[model samples]
Target: MTTNENKSENLIGFNRLNEHVVFDSKKEMNYAVADHLKSNAAFLRDNSKNILNYLAKIASHHNGACGVLYDTIAERLSITKRTVERCMSELKQNNIIEVVKQYSKRGGRMSSVIRILPFVTEKKAPVGEDVGYPVGNESGPEHPKKPSGSKSQSPSEKDTNLSNPLLSSYKQGTVVASLLYIFDDFRNKGLSRPKFEEIVKEAIPEAINLKAYVRSVCSNYVENKSKFTNRFKKHCV
Candidate 1:
C-alpha cells in the first residue's frame, strides 16, 4: 500500500475508536450509582430505588445534577408526593443524595437543585496499602464504652430527622438497610439512638457476616416483638 493510503487508514481507525469511546465523568458516575443500588438487594427498598433511578436518569443528561419537584416525581412514579418526600428524607439521612440549593420566590418555595451521590463502601484497606489517599471514611457509631447523654427530642423530631434536632441518630458510611431498620425499631422503642447504635456497631466486627445476624434481628424484631429485645441482648445487647 502507498504510504499516504496507510496513513489515512490509521487515522480512520483512530477516529472510529474515538466514536465509540466515552470518558465523561458524569456518565460514569451516574452509571455507578445505578449499578450500586441495583446490585445491593438489601441496600434499600424498591420504592427508594425507583426515585433514585429517576433522578439518576435525569442527572445523566444534566451534568450530574437536576432540579427536583416532589409533585413531578410523584406523578411520574405513580406515588404520593408525601411518599417521595419521605423516601428523600431517608436518602438524605443515609447520605445517598444531597441538596445543593433550594429556590424560593414571592415568599413561596420553588424547585430545588439535587445532587446525586454515587454509592461507596467502607472496607478496610489491605495491610501496608496506602491509607494516605482520602476515601469517604465516615466516623460511624462507636462502641458503647461510656454512653454520653444528649437532650432527647420529642417523638416528632425523631421521626422527622431534623438537621437541628436534639438527638443525634445514626448515619452509615455504607448503605445497610437492615441496620437502619433495626435502629428505627429501637427509636420506636425509645432506646437512645446514639447509645444503641454504638452497641450494635461494636458487635458487628465479631460476626462472620451481618446477613445471619441482621436477618435474625429483623425477623424476630417483627415476628416476635416482645421477645426480640431479649434475643438480641443474648447476642448483641
Candidate 2:
C-alpha cells in the first residue's frame, strides 16, 4: 500500500479506538455510581434511595441532566408530593444531586432541572499503577455541619411564602382545619395532628392560596379515597 493509504487506515483505526474508549469509560462510570450507592445504602434515607434511583434512570435517558416534577414523581411512586420534595431535599443535602434551575411561572408552577453528582470513593491505586483519576479518603461534597437547633428548609420552601402573602397568612392550625373539613374520611383515620402539620408545612410552599390548596388536595382525596390511600401510602402506612 502507498503512504497515503497507510495514513487513511491509521485515522480510521484511531477513530474506532477512541469510540470504544469513550463507551467503556461511560459504562465504568455508571458501574462505579451503582457500586457506591450499594455500599453506602445504610447511610441514605429510604426515600432518598428511591429518588436517586429515579434520577439515575432519568439521567440515563436525558444525558446527565433532566427536569423533575414533584407531583408527577409522587403520582408514579405512589407517594405524597411532600415525600418527593423531602427526598429531593435530602439528596441535595447529601450532595447526591444539584438543582440546575428552579421551577416557576407568573401564576403556574413547573419542574426543576436536576443534575446528579458523581459518587466518589476512597479506593487507592496499587503502587506503580496509574489510575488516571484522583482517589481520596473523602467522598462527595462536604457540607458545613448545621448548628444545633437550626432547621433546614428544602429548595421549594426557601422563597415560596415570602413572595406570596396569601400563602403566608394561613398558619398551621388554619391549614389543619381546612384539611379536616374537606377530608372527612381522614377525621377518624387515626392521622396525628403533628403529621398533618408537617404535610401543611411542605405543601404551603407551592400554594398560591394556602387554604384553597389544602381544600383542593383534601377534596381530591375525598373524591378518590382509594387512589389517595394508594398514592400516599408512605404517609398512610
Candidate 3:
C-alpha cells in the first residue's frame, strides 16, 4: 500500500528510499533518456516511457531514485505488477538506471535502490567515475588527474574534450552525433557522423563552444544547411 493509505507509516516507507535526486524536472529526464536512446540506438514504447518519466517525477520527493516495489509503481501508473517488472527490466538493460539492491537493518531485502544517474550534461565528468552533470560546462575539460608522484597518461590516453562526448573509431561517434543534433543546422562538412571529431582532436584541442563551432563550420561548408540537417535528423525521431 502507498504511504497515503497509512498514517504512521510514512516515515517507515520513506526510510527504504535512497536520496539520489538526479533529474530536477521531467524535461531533463526526457533529454537524458533521449540521448541514451539515440546513443545506444534503443527504443522504448509508450508504456515504458510512461514508467521512466514517472520515476523521475516521483524522485523529487524521495530524493530522486524510487525505491518502491513493482506493485507500488503499478498502482501509481495503474499498470500490472508484471508490466512494471518488464518495463523496469527494459530500463535496466538500457543502462539508463542502475538497480542497486537495498537491505534492511536485519539484512532482509528491502526495496531496490534505483539510482537514475543524473544525465551527464555539458559538464566536467567526475574524476574516477566520470560523473559529469548539469546543462553547461563553463569550465574546462575534465581530465582524470594523475596520482601523486605518478607519471601522466600517455599522449594517446589524454582526453582533452569533456564539454561533449568525444568521438572515436569504434564507440563514441554515434554519441557525439546524437548530442549535436540538438543545435539547429548541425551538419558535417564531409567529416562523417560524430561531427568533426577528427578535427577536434587535431585542431580545436580545447573544450570550447563545440556546439557553436559545429554550426559555424557547417554553415561555412554549405548554404541551406538546415534542409540537410532536417533530413539527417529524421532518423533521430
Candidate 4:
C-alpha cells in the first residue's frame, strides 16, 4: 500500500480504539475504511487550514483522544507554546475538535483532553450546551428593590472624563491640545506637523500616561517661559 494509505489505516484503527470496538477482518475492509478516512481527513485539512493536521497526527498516536499538553505539542512541532495554544483555540472555534475533559496540575498548570471529531457527523450543539444549560444563568437573581426616596446621582461630564482618559484629553481646551498648538507656534521647530500628529495619535491609546506626563511638563514650562519650546521638543522626540 502507498504511504497515504498506511496513514489512513492507522487513523481508522485509532478511531476504532476510541470507540472500544473490535474488528475481525483487517484485509478487505481496511482498504475501504482507509479510503473513507483519507477523504474526510483531506477535507478537514483543507477547510480548517491550520495546525490541526499536526495536532491530529499527534492525537492519532494516542488512540484518537488524549490529554495533550500545550508545552509538549509546542516542543514536538518546534513552535512556541503560545502558537500552539492559539491553533488549538482556532480548532475549537471551528468545531474541528472538542475538549472532552480538563486536567489541572499543582502550581496552576493545566491541560485538556481533546477529542478528534469525525469528519462526517450530525451537527452538534454549541461547545458547553451538551453538559446541561447554556453557560450563564438566564434566571439569575434580580436586583433588590431600591429603598424609597433614595436618589442615585448621575455622574457629571468632568467625572466621566476623569474616569476615561481618552474623553478627558479630547475635551475642549484641554492641555494636550494646547501643547500641540503652542509647539506649532515655533517657526524653526525640528519636528514636522505630520510627525507631531503621529506622536499624538500614538499617545492617544496611552492617554492616562500621556496626561500625567503632559501635566507635569506643562506645569514646569509655565514657570519657566524659556524652557517651554525645549521641553516640548524633548517630549515629542
Best by TM-score: 3
State the number of backbone clashes in model 3. Answer: 1
* Per-residue lDDT of candidate 4, residues 102-195 (tens digit): 2222223233345554333223445653311111112223334446663332222112223233333333212222244333333133444444
lDDT of 2 at 20: 17
Alpha-carbon shift of residue 83 in model 2 (angstroms) = 0.8
Give the CA lDDT, 0 to 100, for residue 113 in model 4.
48
lDDT of each: 0.50, 0.50, 0.51, 0.42
Looking at model 2, which ten-residue stretch has the lowest summed lDDT? 15-24
lDDT by residue (tens digit), candidate 1, 1-237: 334323422432432222212225666756767665765558677788888887776555444455546776787789999999888886665556765432222323333455565555544656754322113333333334423453343333232232321112222222232244344444555445455445455444333455456545554544565577678888884
lDDT of 2: 0.50
Q: Give candidate 2's total backbone clashes.
A: 0
Q: Tell me the TM-score of each prediction against the true structure.
A: 0.40, 0.37, 0.41, 0.30
TM-score of candidate 1 relative to the true fold: 0.40
Error of 4 at 82 (Å): 1.5
Q: Which candidate wins on lDDT?
A: 3
Q: Write the per-residue lDDT of candidate 3 for residues 133-182, one digit (tens) a residue.
A: 22232345556775666444433334433344422221233223223332
lDDT of candidate 3 at residue 101, scale 0 to 100: 54
